[model samples]
Target: MRRPLARSWTNWLLALGLSLSGHAFAAHAYAQFGDIRYPASFTHFSYANPAAPKGGEIVLVPPTRQSNFDKYNPFTLKGSAPPSMLGMMFDTLLVGNMDESTTAYGLLASDVSVAKDRMSVTFQIHPQARFQNGDPVLASDVRHSFERLTSKQAAPQYRTYFGEVKGATVLAERSIRFDFVRPNSELPLIVGSLPVFSAKWGLQGEGPKATHKPLDQMVVDIPIASGPYRLGPVQFGKDVTYVRDPQYWAKDLNVRKGQFNFDRITYKIYKDSTAQLEAFKAGEFDYMQSFIAREWARAFTGRAFERGELIKAELPHGNAGDFQGFLFNTRRDKFQDVRVRQAIALAMDFEWLNRQLFYNAYSRVRGYFVASDFEAKGRPGPDELALLLPLRAKLPAAVFEQDVPQPPQTALDPTSGHTLRDHLRQARDLLKDAGWTYRDGALRNAKGQSLSIEFLDSSGSMGRVVTPFAKNLEKLGIQVQYKVIDFALLQKRMDVFDFDIISNRTVGSEAPGTELLERYGSRSADVEGSGNVIGLKDPAVDALLDKVVSATSRPELVTSLRALDRVLRHGHYVVPHWYGAVHRVSWRAKAFARPADLPRFYQPEKLVTTVWWSPHASAAPAAQITQPAPKAP
Candidate 1:
């Protein structure tokens, strides 16, 4: 799922939406697409078994790590930290349903409401919700959390995310409200997902005598939060552990019932995927989500697996498989031309790569949102045309005249069969049309600049993946060089948008919200650290994004996103990569048990952590008969 735009923002901006009936009222859960699934009086989530026993450890080595996290805080940009820091250390106002895309049920806040004008969303904090140190979670604490996240002291991405919120207000003792700059349905949900922490977290003491230090300066101080788990032990870069809170508040809440079952959840850190997977095979860890196709196929086939000590399950879902591709940094003068980008895209033979390198584990990424309802198929239909017609003069003639652009398949001669050679010939025409002619044995533009691509990446294996494409570019008299560097240096370069080409992936979400602005907005195109790493700036894209955000219904959202997907595909922003429709997971057997039913759309890690609990007291993966991942939908 490392393809250009892989969808995993499910947990980042967790599920939300509401019943518009009677303007607004307190509800157990909110869903964007339809009626709420669980009733207000529901005992536990349908996906969770309330009777499942807890009290065993679940060990894991993640596919990636920030490495050497000195700070316990994840809100700031100064340093990196371990995963689940937000949810484990601090509890959000609402817990998003793992099964639903964006449905949110109250966690800390017992009830919530929004003004009819949508200018403000109010939440009534549960009196029972208490922090780790036994302090009540107050309305002021909620305000403090929101103010800190949106302030200049925090990460810039947070400012962009909560930009619509004017400010947080303490309406009363337990009631808190967030005032928005604009009245939008999404604003309430966004604010509802905020992680609430006690004000005493960074402050020294209670009342006016408390001395507050800047949050970014915290090196290794433990966070004072009210979540089910608190920081247990830390070993710097090696690993971190969370001990389940025995006196944790809201343990029996309807939304939280049967969730967070483990007595201790420890996330181990490894240098690379190879080491991590090896650690899992050796039983150093209990669970892993494998990212490498080769490892999944060949590496997990030892005696442990044969003896039922290990299990590999590919869980499938209907979540959108967003694009992951090689991005051309358009900020560079050489890559400004669309034709040149198209030629580069044409050179990446995913069809051949799938058969050879990937063992047919992935499908070629055709458009921005493949494997979902949002992807563009066939010619522009009448509904899509209505949206495109207004911008006809500003768009490409091909947008109206031709079918959407798709990467060429295997091209072979009937008698003297050859595939990639035909692709290279086609690429030659594109570069030639763009005035990059093969003269003096080099492809040079009219300005006398030789065409060269500098592919920058942190992964050493990426160089091998792009090697075949580079050779095809070389056949067209174009220079292609792969640069593999340190992860830290790569992050710095990526922040400043200082690369010719990058084999990068963007995290996508089920519901595309204001985050789209950070990824593709014109303002973020120049901002360092913004998600718009490709430096994409287009009026048409900007317009489409607006349409995407303003969509009012599921049907409207699909229509708008599909139209946006088509336009972005037409822009040739990247060379489509490959994506796996199902989540690849391998875990230790007989340690855990889960509900027979599974949520249709879910992040595998979230599901396991929350719903599954250990039946074996000795500590192992505590889940039921493994449900193998279904074929891609």
Candidate 2:
């Protein structure tokens, strides 16, 4: 879902509270709301320890279920690249701090300047920046990276993300400018975040015979880029290691001063979660962030734990909750009716699952933007109403008449007499009203077509979670098929929107903008490999997305999002799941040291690999560990 800003890019920056129209001068950093926390002279981020030693080989498992990897080009759509390829091997023009949500400081670029008309932005490459091959990073390299990424061979999300940028121009050897199709304030930051690489990459042979391979065809080709790490040893699909570059161009840069502390970071591949946990107990990995509450509560214990060798701890942060749920494919006829979707959603008994399996470790997710200001709460406020009024005809009356929609409550309420039986009755009634009735042995439509759902997943562990729900659906006479396939097949099917129902999680955003378009926009719904996996294609949602991106202030942005959230909830596109408040993690004790000041917003694994340092790293003449910031699960 990573893409450049387009359409409302200018308005999005304005909504961030940036006061700009013209006559903007270059600066060391750019903040969404024009409020830069760290001054230009700041040494390092507060979350990082500049004086800490760095030297360690931390072996960790992939954050998500990555059974294996097949390609080196992460930008392409065809194959799976190894974990941490996005963060470890590429350098962006700007880098964000762990504590901030929307501010980014110069990384490859020393400074950035916006055009007076707000239609373009220019950046000067850091003079000392050099690629892995020791060639200086130039404006031409930036242009090449942008063009290559936007090409058809790359993933379609890249095009949808960078669709707003008109073109890129190399103003000088070290200066490049990005022209926007519209005057978008956020366009500068979006373009600044482009992953730059050496043009020599993918080029084969020498002189005239050197043929440049298409980005997708460059599979398994080692990347040549300016970053803190280089591709290290690999056991093909079994494991991969990243080695830190001692001569990394930005080793002393302010943005990188105390980060990427590991000398060698290895990712061990395990197809099964049970095997992964067993291996971790056997000292196969240095750190692990566990998501399964059963494993965290019961299994994170052994001889290593009693001897203080393995430590299990919970880390706290103020990040937004993930929007996890069982998303229904609206593009399919079975889920087209809102009543039917709501009926299906009513079958999930979160209370029973929380009490029995989860050990009461998670909170039921209610809305798309839960635990955030953008979340829709009570009836639309005046600001939200003002935005929603114009599209009254396109919206459901429930959005304006009712409070924010809540998942079916299985807990007993003496006053309302609500329970799991009541929920099942409501589901049955809703299905009947939607032209479905129990006939023969299953719920069937007018044509005797049975209502069926295949709960598709890549992990076998999901069976425990989906079994109870499937049983509840069976009570409603709906056929439930739970299938756990391999990760690669699951990914390929997902790319083509080839599933009836699938469980997925989307990361929450603090300053959400154009990315919303790719998630729920009508144009992106048809684009294969786009984030709109639920196949939502609503004109009303599309209009709300525009309002969200074009919002002029923080209040306006919040209002627009609230309105959008209300509409999305009313649509019943997903059956909400649950989220944990604290990050549950386990690590080998006495292996790493971290700064006392914790970041306000950060993933557990990112903090572990990037900010934590080794006590004996400086002991060696040149530590060879490479730190990688893998995504949070």
Candidate 3:
């Protein structure tokens, strides 16, 4: 998952250049790797249709566990916000093209430059950039965005993401500079993705005097940021609509062109997935990105398909596969033992679950950053060894002595010897070795403490998914309890790192940067609401994370990540889950159309909101259409 890059770099990339005074070196675009598909003079993104139509509204049921939204603010950690709030209202300094994974073109900032020392990056605000209230996007606004996001008032992820940034300075009326803690290659691009909004947002406008309020208390405040849309209407906690701005400043920009096509986008909040899918069948919404394999295979049939009003398609994407599993909160004493964690993981009969529950719709998730260059496979190479060798004392011997551990395979056929029984036997052995044994009905430690687990969740809908695993744990003499609490309550619990195990995942990145620290770093392990849910605090992991963030080249980055993957795998922080081969989706056929070339790496809602348009409107319609969601990013 996309994480934060926070700290002083151990190995700063040294690119030679002269940091001359008043020597402005500007570019219209920037790439993590030095390849830009669209030149500076380009008028539109390759994936967007310049003349696509707008006007028709698209209503959707969000794929979140929360049934309703209580806030307009999307950046906070407390409450849920509508899906269209962030992308529709706020704009970032740069916008990455979907076709290419690592390139970003100017969005809010017209020109961007990096200092020769790579210690700072500068941005010149676009002359045409304007807020929804018609205020010009000033240098102060950029600084305000950075300050507020990195401050205590905003969400912890922002602070963790931009933590390495030393400070944001207003260079001029239309220019700003962001100085870094160290000169890293990806810092500029990371800073470019910062969401910029008018400082006037979340203010208490008393007559003519708008009083500034802290971001933490600005939960339900209406935002005044500039984007394609503004808050149109709301039905309390039921639904929220975003109205497209007719005079949006960046509407004609090359980076925008044919995006944000709908005149109005609405979201209907449903408490249950079954109800949500039924609503789609009844034409209450335009699209449904189904995650339940049973619902996708069985429920998406009947009248709509028979009348050619609905379409179901499995869309392919090349994005990094998202890792989802039972994330162990390592802060808990019971989970601190690696052998106990390993033993518990051995009991997930994925083969049996795949055939019985998921209709064999998933492939085993092998490792973090799976299907990417970062995933550790086969053996540790010479480059990875260089990094891993120094941390041998902090890591397990198996990391250097053997290939990374793969998930335990259970045979699908009845006659095969490799089955649940075989893996359970291995699990018993590991548990015995870890000083745990079946005693007085439950596994007890040396202190006579029985192994107890609570599968913490929100909405209680995942009981079916956890039931089998809990049953398996019961087989190993473990006390298993499952409880589904409120979403807000769960968030509160996770923030304080108070949990036994939680079903969670991270949004993976194409080129993982310092954000690796926020995920597994020692510093973030104790930080409340930090993404390091596993509470991983190994010095070897922290060191490898530092290497991954500051790597000058792709080879070095991959090597560092492999070293990290090996270490974490051996640690067994989470039970590896499964991934889908394709994004399974069901959308209304006659409503919207998309670009000829679908983006290789994208989320389902992202594709619908950004590129898809309605043919019923006056302008030219985009051709082709889309799939579902699963990727972390």
Candidate 4:
């Protein structure tokens, strides 16, 4: 997760030419901690099969829980965009292979070099790289992309994500340099991951009559980019298809060789998982990854599954467990106190929910970085103390005095001496101490304001999951309302931090950096459309985030993250949920073939779109790839 820098792009552009020389050499690959896996001459990633045949179409549902997409521009804040567009239709300067944690190989850029002072990174664009219209990619286009993404017209999060980078400058027709505010190891990868698109995208009319729409207003304009696929067929809100470009520029590039095997990919939208599951059983799509344990266990059955026409498999991954939980917006005055937050969190009985609802398919999430080395364990060590001691005045006593906080447990395991009743009693006591007394059939604060909670979400599928938690909150005399709204409205409310509570899962990364700042930094807390969904504004947290991003080594990064984790866990800002170690996926048998070696970290959509291919597809097969859908207005 990257964050916006404090300074404006104009400031950085003016600060260019500060007398710094680029490094004497360049490399085909770069890594955060100086650990590069593949050599410069390597053919393709070990996880990809170069010989994989590619003419077939593979249909899949959106990996996320979105019901419909309303915009083609994903960078805007107003509406939900199709999840498939960014990855399929946009190209980045550098791309990271799934097998490696932090290493990046040049994609659009052929050579990359970092300044000796570490304040800048330069890239030489590939001359062969061309947009869908066959125009060559230029340094000016890279600069245009950076400026556009960091501008106010785009989502505010990008400004915060690229906040450290002063600005991008075109050194030559095919060369560009990005100047950072300070020396940081992660800055190179930060800028490298930038999604670059043609400057001509989203333009209407021609010559004097031409007009360029703001990113948010380009709702249906097809994006012109240098990606492997182009927007093919669309049914406005129901489904979208992507057709592989026959003249894709980097088809033979060393880093891209066996990937993006599908000639055509289609994504179907459904209102709910039940409908999606029925459609999958009816062969409406080729694959589905089930997040609901009950659906995977009880509902994924029929003659098609019995006869092995559909295969159910749990594919294990080494990626960190994504932090899924009920995030409390601290911006609200009702949740301002730490004790009140702590009291509310205790009402969630994860042990009961996992046993009764999830069918023991998950483990309780311990912290923000669960299942990763960054997750703080037991107590702070000497290194953590060295970092935490300086900010002790601004932090809570629990940061240093207590062990890492754990979710309240019940007597699901006999040895765990507590029960749900005991936990609720504890919650009641905490609420009382916080001046919230249960009277008038409600938990009222000293001013007689009833403590109310609205659990906001876009889908009703989580109604069952929240029911038990709501029941527990009701016991405390709290007014709990779980409202399910449309995705666009939900997004709009979330942007302004308008809800009391929302359940979200921040995707985990092997090498987490700038993204942490966006999620927890004080600078981002008040920024609308920012990733700081929790409304965290602690200066101590802000200090630690700087250290995490600027750390020079892997050990240093881990130590900083662990300390930060301990501080965040002590805040009690979230009601931690459960996570599964493997993906519960069911795909049509004989429809596709995958590589023998599984990448250590990947999502279901990535695996399906990137490395999997149809076994029977031919170069000139006579199959209609997709049904013509209604065009966008």
lDDT of 3 by residue, 486-548 (tens): 777788899998899999866666778778888888888888888999998888888888888
Residue pairs in clash, model 3: 1-507, 1-508, 2-507, 3-515, 4-515, 5-514, 507-632
Any runs in candidate 3 off by more than 4 Å, and if so which? 1-25, 203-211, 413-417, 459-461, 618-633
Error of 2 at 203 (Å): 1.5
10 residues in a row with least lDDT, candidate 2: 624-633
- Per-model TM-score, in order, reads 0.89, 0.94, 0.92, 0.94
Model 2 stretches astray by more than 4 angstroms: 1-22, 205-210, 413-417, 618-633
Clash count for each candidate, listed in order shown: 17, 10, 7, 10
Candidate 3 vs candidate 4, lDDT winner: 4
The sequence of per-residue lDDT tens digits that candidate 2 reaches over residues 547-606 is 876664566678888899999999999999999989999998877778887888888888
Error of 2 at 619 (Å): 8.0
Q: Rate the local accuracy (lDDT) of all candidates.
A: 0.75, 0.84, 0.81, 0.85
Show model 4 residue runs off by greater than 4 Å: 1-25, 204-211, 413-416, 618-631
Candidate 1 vs candidate 4: the TM-score winner is 4
Over all chains combined, what TM-score does candidate 4 have? Answer: 0.94
Return whichever of 1 and 3 wins on TM-score: 3
Alpha-carbon deviation at 217 in model 1, angstroms? 2.8
